[model samples]
Target: MAERSTADLALTLTRASRTPLPVQVADGIRALIMSGALAPGDALPSTRFLAQRLSVSRGTIVAAFDQLISEGALLASQGRPTTVHPSLPAHLLQQVSAAAPDPTAASTRRPASPGASTAAAPGRPDPVPAPAPASAPAVDLRPGLPRTTRIGDAAWRSAWRRAAAAPEAETGGLTGLPDLRAGIAEHLRLMRGLPTDPAALLVTAGSRDGLELILHALAATRGTLSIGVETPGYPGLRRVPQVLGHRIVPLGVDGNGLRVDALPTGAAAPDAVIVTPSHQYPLGGSLSLDRRLALLEWARNEDALIIEDDFNSELRYTGAPLPPLSAIDPHGRTVLLGTFSRLLSPDLAVGFVRPTGAALLAELRDVREVLGVRVSATTQHAVAHLLADGTVRRHTRTERLRLGRRREALLAAMLDVPGVRVLPMHGGSDAVIRFDTAGSHRGRAGADPEARAVAACADAGITVGRLSAAWGAESQAAPVDPSPAAAVGGVGGAGIVLGLARPADGAFSAMLPRLASALATVHHTR
Candidate 1:
């Protein structure tokens, strides 16, 4: 229930016909047309009607309408009536229209598909939309904890300045920066507790890009390769290896992270294992130390490569920093992949990969250059400076505290609303909450009661990424196991992952009552 905006108002005014009044008339019309006072194709009152209403001569109203028409902004006609031009002032139109529902619907014979290209949508403002229902639904608290607007302008400015000043050659076109490798190696040594040589470091566009490079490098390394991916684990995360023709085995993860003891041997044993040891996503949990030790042993015993995704390692709030699996891999069998997206921001487009040995590292670097997957030296420099200046590290400390408190508040408010259980947020910007039906762990079906809750929330103008979207949106997935003993899991009830980071200040504080009211009347239906 949004209040009418000022843009919805119309203008009622007249001017003397003897003198030119272009500015006043334009301003008046602008206010009306921009405001919804006059909609597209909506007829305007006759000149005489406006003139009499404004206590001015009909000639003046005619002159104003004539001027508006001449500017190609307003459509004016005597018998047919006049209205705002459908396409004038494109920017302002986008602002209003971005919020409008399928404008093309009226003209089409049938409704267009949601992803139809014929549908028109314009670019949004640079800053993330205000959290409290702006022109659109607010608070898209989904998992993956994407904080698109989290990166401060100061950091962007510095990064941009460095990027703008650096030579293009430094970005793997030949003029490489040895100092960057040195600094990066030192930083990883201290922060990630990984001992590595500077020459082994190769900057990558992202962790996924790093993964792609690994797949490309490993494509023919050993005879037929099969990799293991955690089930319901980051769907987009496993696509790189799969597209490269590697067979994917589904590995189950519980509270201990990926079950190392569950590694299938013989043909089932994967040549590589991808695990997010530091804050496992979806089902948020850290890898237990014993499991971490076993994972190292599994890789060693099976003679496999372990891909450790240390994404979002810096924002740990509940416990001390856990050592990455790579830190414990003494046999040099693990390839460590990480990104600044979680800690710094996603737009930075910077990630790094640490290989096990100098030979593997050198080979990957050569492949990286051949494949053109390097980040610019200036970006590396800017992040280095920010880290050196203590801004990024300092920001991490503050955001962790703020996010922890906000996460708690969001969880409390959601829990108070009947049928909603807020999943704890121990590691990232979002708090995943489940409602309506039961979790997928329960062997039941038709738990669509959760969908009723989602529908109620949608009616109140909340947009969320649901459990189904998260599961099926990605193109690649771990293979389904058909073991006779394997229990078929049910799809979790309508679950909503709410991001505490995106809400406008105090928006979460204000949304609880509206949410609770909606939930109060929600009930399951077939």
Candidate 2:
């Protein structure tokens, strides 16, 4: 039995409007709650009482209450009166009350034209939305994370339900469940134009997992091999190798991506090289066809391997994505590492590796199982369901449109900001912005412009990835003049990686001015 409030609320319902009666009722209640007419702990009328007053079915009232409860607008409990959610922050309540119209004066107030509302009244000042909370972090633009808001509620629920229904160990194996591997293979073939056999695919947790597994397999065969990693690239890639006790050879990436010619020849050459050919990490540049062929040629000649990180290749907005390096490697020297992090979310941790052969696949599985490194069986099943049901494909389309819009917004906002160079993005989840502060401040404290910009962004609560930090320890150890103007990797100086897709809806546009202001700080003060 639930208690009911005696207070009566004024609500207007129109049968002529396209909006449903239940929705109208919910909106009316929400307005009252937001406008301070209904305070926290104030009881909501019982469904029966409200239904009788509004002349609607009890079911309709229930539906309205349920909607409000789902949105945290109202709180409901067993054997207790339904009331406004008390846990809501005071600032939010204040914001709503400030924005909402006066309920007592509603009947006396005359409707104003849309244009009229845009301007402040002659005697009364226009109501402005409350400022965002001071504690909230500014829009995070660090690369790698993706936006998952576009995933439809129905599709998400269906995937999770299917996952929940399936028994954990029933369908999973060491290299991931057979169904999931097959699903990944099919997805690759259809979306990436990479014809992969399920037998050759080994599902790992993510790109790092796949890389570690490959390193294990490589170590078993080659024994303590030296690996070439892209300099001023993903530090995790370098760190993962170091953890495995493999010697890291720092390789540089230019406008085209990892420089193949920079690799040592003969005895000094690394046994294998890891490259992000399909939109390089941190810096969003795709490997050129000539370089791809050259890389494959190098691998074939040295009898070495090329671990291709096909990260965010599927999210290319402009033209068709270039064929993956693995696709071009006819000698079976290329191994592809991919993940669902950008497609879906990082929490899935669902990634796969297309090994060079069955031998490598078997070795990877053995290493993974022996080391007890396995993704949750439930997550694998959910991802597999998404792939098989074409939910991922539909979601990818929506994500691409969203990413494109955000990228455009970021570029447009930074266009006028001094000393901030927006690099061209071929196709990837992130964009790079180089900072050039020449004559601002040249002292020891303000030597590196990239460092200054990163600190400024941090102070402003904007989380952005620094390009200089991406360099391997070995790369950073290289001799330099210690001058800020010393250009590295063809760029004038260092930059920051912006994950455009990470911002919430309507957040990117709102934070653009703040971002510009932050960049200006570094641009002007050295």
Candidate 3:
């Protein structure tokens, strides 16, 4: 087989189409392989090269490549060019060639349904099993998902019954139901040790919506602000700002969470900074006391707003939980974002934004009046009932114990996996594992052990989060730096972010050995 140039692939991508660019790329490559245009041993263009040729983000190309690799349609090893799987049966290639549809009649042909399968002609091997149906993973280890099944059915029913019995309000009002606000204020005071006025908190759809509300309010006063976000931070929160026309300045994090010293000054200073002080996402490092103080001081000096996402703070398994930045902000520069998504259920679509300063509170209120209330009166009342009756609190305590056991199990399972280190995570619903990509464990020039580990887990009916994905698209185009400071500016090290909230206790325990085995395989292969 001749070595193919980057242009030889000639992938056609339609931006206007509903399908994603990565899927289009993967489908094109798969078609080429099936048609024998790309032979069994034919090498493919590098992701970067192909991304450049296609005028798409390198991350897009990487996703396509990863999907192909996972489907066994391509072969990839550390430091070598990706190639068509050398073991693809010759008969399959011949069969596809013989059955090739005419380009002239392509538009006239009906597309096959996603689940439709072609029966094998004569005695040909079944078409590679169609890459496993896109069903829910038997063991889902993705982060941000909480175990909602643990909530007592009695408590759940009682909360809703109370909500249903309450006199209906014409509107949830601009800031949300007064009762819900009061309930949230009390909940925060008791649980998070942050005393807040119910009037100061504005109801939002969730944390992301809370963030959007903050940005909208802030942007109303200040035009497109430069917002500092932790590198390798939660993409869900990061995307909210980006989509709202704000510029994102990537900040680095370490063992103690967001690096205070790295905060840019002068012209580079951000107008606002978002931090997960209680428990950082993916990395699971809480901001240290010193760093928290420093961050508050920096915010005061720079006159920058601090957005604290206090999601999953109550789920900490070990040690006393730290006070939220909003609780300690003496200058009233912080706005706290909270959500029922992690503690209760995401289906509730309920959360709140509490600003420390009276001025900011007024600003958020004014913005809310203009935007109108999003949460329904019924939902707000339901959540208020939950909080008022201590159901939420008791449920939270139970979930903490349940999730703690899961976290401990995850730790115990990975303890003996060679070349893999599960980073210490005190709270939060997820844990991170860094791969030993250097020294003797360094596989090949370009091998990504973290990616391979994730692929292996996927092959075993387990789905896990990729650490590299947290760094955004640019990181995906190339190899991760794997340095402690690699994520200083959104670039990150190689690892997997394992969510501990999905599988049941027994199922999770059963999945751990499989997960550990996958890690071991990646290590040995490297």
The RMSD of every model to the true structure, in order and in angstroms, is 26.3, 23.7, 28.0
Screening candidate 1 with a backbone cut-off below 3 angstroms (N, C-alpha, C), the clashing residue pairs are 7-35, 7-36, 8-36, 141-497, 141-498, 141-499, 436-450
Greater-lDDT candidate between 1 and 2: 2
lDDT of 2 by residue, 145-214 (tens): 6774747889888998999999755656677788898889767755564556687788888988889888
**Model 3 misplacement above 4 A:** 1-137, 439-446, 473-490
Name the top lDDT candidate.
3
Which scores higher on lDDT, 1 or 3? 3
Record all residue pairs in model 3 with backbone atoms less than 3 Å apart, i.e. clashing.
78-447, 79-446, 79-447
Q: Per TM-score, what order, best first? A: 3, 2, 1
Q: What's the true lDDT of residue 327 in model 1?
A: 54
- Give the poorly placed runs of model 1, Cα more than 4 Å off: 1-137, 167-169, 172-176, 436-447, 469-494, 516-526
The worst-scoring run of ten residues by lDDT in candidate 2 lies at: 115-124
Clashes of each: 7, 1, 3
lDDT of 3 by residue, 417-483 (tens): 9988888878878888888765544555536776677777877767777776667542222222345
TM-scores of the models, in the given order? Answer: 0.65, 0.70, 0.71
- In terms of TM-score, which candidate is stronger, 2 or 3? 3
lDDT of 1 by residue, 1-526 (tens): 1111111112323343544554555666655454333445544556766555355567876788787787766775555656666557675444331212221122111111121111111111112222444543455554455555565788768766865677666554321356555555655643443445666677777788889887666653564456677654666676666566555666765544565666787645777788888766555667777778788777767767788888566666654345566655556677788777667767777777877655556557667667874666777777766655456555766677777777666666666566556654556665556654433323345335445556666666665555444342221333333342222122222455555666665666777666666565553232
